[model samples]
Every structure is written in structure tokens, then in C-alpha cells.
Target chain A: MFKVGITSLCLSVLLVTSINASTSGKLLLSGGVNQVEGSAGGGLTPWAFIGGYGTEDEIGANAFITNVKSSDYNMVSTGFVVGFYNRFEFSFAHQSFDTRDVGATLGLGQGYELKQNVFGAKVRLFGDGILEQGNLFPQISFGLQYKKHEQGRVVKSYGAKDDSGIDFYLNATKVILSESLLMNLTLRATKANQIGIMGFGGDRKNNYELMPEFSIGYLFTRKFIAGFEYRFKPNNLGVATEDDWLDVFGTYAFNKNFALTIAYAYLGNIVLKDKQSSLYTSLQVGF
Target chain B: MFKKYTVCLLLLISCASTDKLSTYHDFGEKKGIEKVVDDLFVYLLKDERTKESFQRLNLDKTKEGLSNFICVTLEGPCKYEGQSMKRAHKGQEITERQFYGMVENMQKAMNKNNIPQRAQNKLLGKLAAMHKDIIGN
Candidate 1:
């Protein structure tokens, strides 16, 4: 089912791009890069801006592949996102987590992989994050992500209550052109453990908890941006303590069609490992 | 050490005064504005995305009006005698893409004219306020 959905999504993007849409209007790097969950945003969190270079009269789409590797683990995420009329965005991402030596220590075998799929939808509520520099009002958006894990039985055995969950978030973003700064705040409510890669809920907590994510970026030039992101996570499982995520990242847009992002992320703890630091990199291509 | 601190303080004061210069001065005043306007016209005409809309207008008058408008926006001494944004774009049927395409041209022009990024942002901030009046009318 997931394969079919992804195939259709790719087909639709091709179908739409073959039409009369031309990409020549939006400012350089105004369209945010694809986030971890395929939403248009920073490395870790979604921002209010819809993905792509499409203005109000056009459709835009992006495809991205990202990899994060640490001493104990490796993760790969790839996805596509489409924006419609600058009002709505739909995205899909698939993540595969490889537990290297840690999996063997836990008796699961070396290179045990945990995979999950994320489907997201977002709507612009109001305001213009960019262009409206005359006011303090930020562009607001509401979004939701539904995640399903492939290792349902294994996660349940590890004290997770469910293998799937939903996350709802409200995002606010603003770009102060005069100061060359961009700020974003997102409040997400979810019951996912480790962003649903280890399944949803757990023996310790079954109720949804609200988490906050924030990012601040400075535009060094029209082509380059550097920023920091902090994402608070909920600790729901009794087996291991989950930790918040933080990253310092930089993005350089080669042009409207391609962008490269690299980040040094400190992922506090994932299951048995503590103090996991990783290098995260992503490449985005779009119209 | 005390003498060095005093000298540094004096230099800081002078730098503050330079920073206080208005965006118009940063733009190199009238000649700079004219150069930017001329380059802007060249880009708008050469670009396929914006050439059609610009081709229907009078090039010389449009250039003069844009220069005056930008001058006024940057708080220069010039007086603008052109039509209001709403009036000038009354039936142009400009889409959001076209509006941004023009902004792109202006940015390229400003870059070619050696305007500082901070000054360019101030100008863009002022002009962005006119977006509502110019788009989708």
C-alpha cells in the first residue's frame, strides 16, 4: 500500500509539472528545505512556509534524501512534498533506522533495521511569513503527521502500546528581512516514542503530550543560511529514556532547483545508547 | 591601556555616525538610483517572465516613475509625481508570480548597482508594503 501511494504521488508530481507551471518568481532560498518528516522547514522541524518556489498561482514540489549517522546507528530518510497555490502542502517520508552493534547487544542481530512511514498534510491558517515585513504578525499553519512502524511486534514487546500514531502541530514562522533573520515556533501534540520509529505510546505514558520545537536562522547571503533548532521530545517508554533533539545547521542554495544542508546533531539518547552525536546531511531538488 | 581604550571609543563613535547614514546615501543618491532603474528595465525587458507586461507600457515614462517611486521609498529628496500603486496597476491583472518576478528583477538591478545588502533590504521592506495594492487588482 505504501509503495503504491508513493508511486502515485510521484506520478502526480510528474503530471502536474508537465503542465503550464513555470518556476521563476519566488525569491532565492525563500522556499524552505524539506525537513526530516518531509515538511518544508529546517532540519528537524516544520515551518509555516509551504514547500517549493510556487507562488499563489502555481504548484510546486520537492524531493529530498537525507542521511544521519552516528557511532551506534544510521538513519536514512527520503520523501517528496507538494505545495498547492501556496495554501496547502502534502508530504510523505520513509525512514529506516539501522541499529549497528547495539542491535546485536540487544540480541536482535547486527544491522537490525526499523522502518517507518510518515504522511503529512498542512494548511496555511493566515499571515505571510515572508514579504510582509511591515508588521509583527507571523504566518501561522496547522499540520498533522500520521506514522506507521514496520516493526510493530518488536516495538510492542519493548513496552510500546501501539505501532502507529498521529502528531498534530501548529507552526508560526516569520522572516525579518531587515535583520536577515528567520524564526519559527512549532507546538506539537503526540504520543509517539522517538518520533514513532520505536512505535507509539508506551507502558509509562499513553496520553498525548505537547512538545515544542523552535528554530532561528540568519541569512548570510541570498544563497546561504545558518541556523539552530531545538526540538523537545516526549519520553513515553519505560524501557529507555528518550531525549530532546538539537542541531546546528547550514543550508546553501546552489539555485532554485537544488539546495544542500548539513548539520551537527546531538541526539541525546536513543534506547540503550547515550550521548549519540551524528552528522546529518540532506539534498533537496525541486522546481 | 587607558589611551588605547579612549582611541577605540573615538573610532566607535565615528563608525556609528557612518552607520546612521540614510539608505538614500547608501544607494549613492540620484545617479545610483538612475543606474539601478536603467538596469532594472533591461532585466525586466530581457526576462521572458516579465517582458510581456512591460512591453505594453511606455519604457521611458515607466523608468522615470519607478526611479521616483524608489527614491521616495528610500526617503530621498525627490518628489514622486507618478500614479499611486493602486491606480497604476488598476487593470494590469498582475499575478503573485509576476509581482515577485518584478521584485527579482529589482534585486538583480540593485546587485548590479552595488547597493549594500542592508540598504537593499530597507528598500525592499518599504516596497513590500505596496504588494497588496499592486497584486491581483
Candidate 2:
């Protein structure tokens, strides 16, 4: 896990080395940092802005490394993203979930782990979150993410229905410019259990569910932002009850190319651990 | 079911959003706005991305117009008697970068003028609505 995070950062640094001259761009922090799934937006809900540092007529790329640690477990997620013409985006993210003692207790092993890869794409459907001062409609985006979990044997032993699948979502982001407020609402259809850490389905059911996620932020400056996020997860596995998640976070862009983020999250549950709260942090470099 | 959905929708709509005009006016009185406007031009003139567009600009008129614009936009006791926002930048070929650059300068000016973050953001929020109109490209 440690090596994975280091490699993610190294790759991001390599990605940022090739810089393309930029044109006009979105407000700082408005394009959003890389979400856990490697999509652009809040720490959870993806925003409408295209990934990377590009504006409308230019091209840009970015890389991010994130780590979340708690008393019960730890996780590392990292990925790279490319934005084309500020209208479309493509991204790839890798995540490692370490079960620690819980895996041993669950009869798996002392150091069992679950790893997954997520590939995502998004398009700006319509509206400009920053410009709609007079309009009620917010900027909207449609996105799809395909998630595949490794360690299929462990998931199968736990009664998972599948090891790979896709999650579809539509996001609406609005900037109440006068109020200096940023808001996002995401509607997702998914069936992964514990985000596929424990597998896809269980005795409860084997079907997809429509869920809503949201984030609201306030810009302290052109370079700093503070916000809150909420995401509703599907409880496809019945062995352990799943809970919705929420977090309070802040992000600061040192410049256009690098940023630092910190957050305290209430992750609800993680596999067998209940009230799985944690401290989350990530570094992002974009061009 | 329909009534429940309507109520939720209305709640969301209300959640979508502010303070009244007078509270906003306190960010800067007329004198404060003048200083912020001056500081804004200074930064704009210094910014490489935006300096070119402002080179041939008229200083006095721009300052006077911007001060009034800020005041009136905040519903203060002043009227923006200048040309419309669109007409003022008609042929500048203003790119998105320049537009955002201008906003950055404005924020710096507000910060230098000792404007509180709350007031500065409120002012910015008011200006953000004009993003579409400000960009000529």
C-alpha cells in the first residue's frame, strides 16, 4: 500500500512534467480536485468541470494521490486524469483496501486486502455553474465509472454476486456566485457492496439502486475552498449493514499546478467495522 | 406522493441559496469601493495575462465607472451610469483566462483594501454572474 501511494505520486509528477500552454480556465477550486474514483469534483461527488488544468480551448492533464487512515483500517487511492477542450474527460484510478485484523477475524487472513481499478469518463451536458447568476439551473454533467475488484476468490467466499461492474451517475453543480457558494447534486445507479470490498451482492438482494450524493462548498479566496460532502451507498450485502457517508473538507491550491487537501470523514461502516471514521488527505498536481 | 415530491423540491430550491442588499453594502462604502477599484486596476495592469487588454484603456474613466459599477451592483446608493458591461468590452477578444485573471486581481485588491473574506466573496459572487457577458471570445 505504501509503495502504491508513492508510485501514484511519482506517476502524477511525471504526468505534470509535460505542460501545455493554457487559455481561459475555470475558477480555481471550481474544476474540483480528483475525487476518490479519479473523477473531477468534491472528495466524493464528481463536479461538472472537466478534469485537468485546461480551459475551454486548451488541453490539460493531472495526477493525484490520496490516503485515508483510521483506527480500524487504511486505504490508498491514486489516479491520473486528462481533460480535452474542457468539454470531456477520461480518468483511471487504482485503490487498495487493507483489511488488517478484521480480515483475520472474518476468517480470511491477518493481512488480507482488496484492490480495485476504476475507469471513468464524463461530459459537460449543459449550463455553467459559475455564470448562471440570473438563471436557476446549474451546470450538469453525465458520467460513467467501471469498477473491477481483484481478489475475486475472497469476494466469492463472502457470497458476492460479481467481481466487476459499472456505476452510472449524473451530476449537477451550481455556483451561486453572489453568495460565493458551490453546490453539487449527483444521482447514481449502483450495486457494489462496500464499494466492492466485500463483493457485489449478498443475501439481501442482487439489484442496482438509485442513490443521490451531494457536496456544498464556499470559496475563501481564489485559491482556497471549504465544503461538505454527502454520499449515499447501496447496501447490496446483508451480512453487515451499510451506512451513508459524510465529510467536512478544505482544499488549497498553492498555484495552478499543485494543491493540498485535508478532510475529516464519517465513513459510517467498512466491512465489519462500525462507525468507521477517519482522517483523509491527498495531494494533487495538474497542468 | 405528488405533494410530497413538490414539497421536497421546494425545500431544495430554498436550500439553493443569501443576504439582502444593505448587508452587502457594508463590504465597502463609496470611499472603500474607490480604493478597491483602484487596487483592481493596479493588479490588472501588472498581470501578464490581462496587462495587454488594459494598456490602451483610460484610467480615470475606468476607475470612476468601476467604482460606480460596484456600488450600484451591490444596490448601494449609486447608479452605474456607464455603458453596459457587454458594450464596454465589445471588441477586446477577451479570453477566459483574461476574465478569470481579472477576477483574481479584483480579489487581491479587495484583500489589500482589508476587505473581509465574507464581503469579498459576496462581492465576487455578485460579479461571477457576469462571467458570460464579460468574455468576448
Winner by lDDT: 1
Write out the backbone clash pairs for model 2: A24-B97, A177-B125, A178-B125, A178-B126
lDDT of each residue in A1-287, candidate 2, tens digit only? 66867876776666555543442365666678998889998887788878876667677777888888866888888887888877899998888887889989998787677899999999999987876676678888999988899887778777788888788999899987656678899999888787666667666878889989989998877788899999999876766788888989999998777889999988887777889888989898887
* Model 1 residue A101 lDDT score: 92
lDDT of 2: 0.81
Q: Given candidate 2, what's the lDDT at residue A91?
A: 94
CAPRI rating of model 1: medium
Best by DockQ: 1
lDDT of 2 at A172: 92
CA deviation > 4 Å runs, candidate 2: A8-24, B1-25
What does candidate 1's lDDT look like per residue over A202-266, in tens digits? 99999999999999998876778999999999998999999999999999988776789999999
> What DockQ does candidate 1 score?
0.64
Worst ten-residue run, lDDT, model 1 chain A?
A: A1-10
